[model samples]
Target: MSTDTPPPLPRQPAAEAARATEPASPGIAGVDDTGVPAGGGDAAEVGRGFFRALFDLSFRTFITRRLAAVFYVVGLMAIGIAFVVYLVTGIVEGVGALWFNPGAGISLIVATVILVPLFAFLAVIALRFVIEAVVALIAIAENTERTAANTRR
Candidate 1:
């Protein structure tokens, strides 16, 4: 018999291949294909879900992911306010120091101008990291829940 090889089987689409290889993850309850809450960021739907999750005695859903944006804004505002207060105080102190020692006062002013903003920037960065960490944890929880849902079949 002549040696021959059959044509390779057609490749499945990426989405279909992934689906075939893994258990069908229906996703977290009320979540969409992208894993966001299913109502699609509509203000009313998000507001409703936010409140519902809060009072959910069974603890079946979470609200933090939805409120993360609000938290970030509030955190930014707090940091900004703190920055303003510190900057004002530093300038005042620096100005007052000008009466006693001109060189040291100039140095203080320069240091304050440079370092206070740097520290404020660092604070903002830190706040962002913390918010990102929280969101990441929420995503992990959602993925875990989805996996559990898949297995419960």
Candidate 2:
């Protein structure tokens, strides 16, 4: 076996390597990049960046899902409270008024009270479906992107 080690590979100069790795521009070229110049302290630029971050696809989705969950819970609670109130009202008004009333008004009110719970329940279910549908669509998009990348490779 040869005692000498193989010669070290030729190395690229640091500056040349840096130029090859980085884009020609060191800082953001415009509002599209959303990056403030180095040492930039402009409040206007900061505000733009904040809004840009909020408008990003990932951030928007996060906010949407969080708000949806909050609304879902609040809706469910409101429906439960309404059901309880309706139950109490039916009991106080006398259950006979729901089916039999001298005037059509009491009967309509009773019917509305009963149907409101069903409508609210359906609304909650619809909201849940919408949220789940959004998640499934996003997952499908990610899967498609992954498959595309793998195929390209």
Candidate 3:
């Protein structure tokens, strides 16, 4: 035998050599590539992520459903309060006119007779609107609560 070592064995083909050099892709035994695990973290993280997404969706739905009605009611109450202030101011001015000039008392009397009934009608309507809005808000709350309970189940 010769003292020098023999040359190394022949090199593999390019494709085979490349594949052999690289690590094999990881895989699940019973599942496809799409079903492979994330390689880190506990299973409970999946459940937590699902719940967070669900809560976000529910909150968005609730706001979308009630936002219009909530704004409408708020607008109605604001207008109603403004009207009440106008009525009060009108009455105070009329009183002042009557005190300073008795001749204007007849006009004030006529205005009171006409405007008091109109304002009363408006007030009644505003009260009804407020009551309806409150009822609707309560109904929405109950419905949302029921939906949340059902979703939990």
C-alpha local distance difference test of each model: 0.82, 0.62, 0.61
lDDT of 2 by residue, 1-153 (tens): 676888776598878888889966654364223222242568898667666757897642233432455666876787778777876665556555645664554765666677767876786787678767865665566457657988994
**Alpha-carbon lDDT of model 1:** 0.82
| Model 1 regions more than 4 Å off | 1-34, 40-46
Query: What does candidate 1's lDDT look like per residue over 55-131, in tens digits?
Result: 99998887777777889899889988988888888888888999998887888889889998999899889988998
Ten residues in sequence with the least summed lDDT for candidate 1: 27-36
lDDT of 3 by residue, 1-153 (tens): 676878777678788888887756555344344332243557698556546645794553233222445665666677667767766666677778888886686577567657865876686577667765765675577567768998994
Q: How large an RMSD does model 2 have?
A: 13.4
Cand. 2 TM to true fold? 0.42
How do all the candidates rank in terms of TM-score, highest first? 1, 2, 3
For TM-score, candidate 1 versus 2, the one ahead is 1
Instruction: Please give the distance, in angstroms, between residue 56's alpha carbon in candidate 3 and its true position after superposition.
Output: 28
Ranking by lDDT: 1, 2, 3
Q: Tell me the TM-score of model 3.
A: 0.35
Q: Count backbone overlaps in model 1.
A: 0
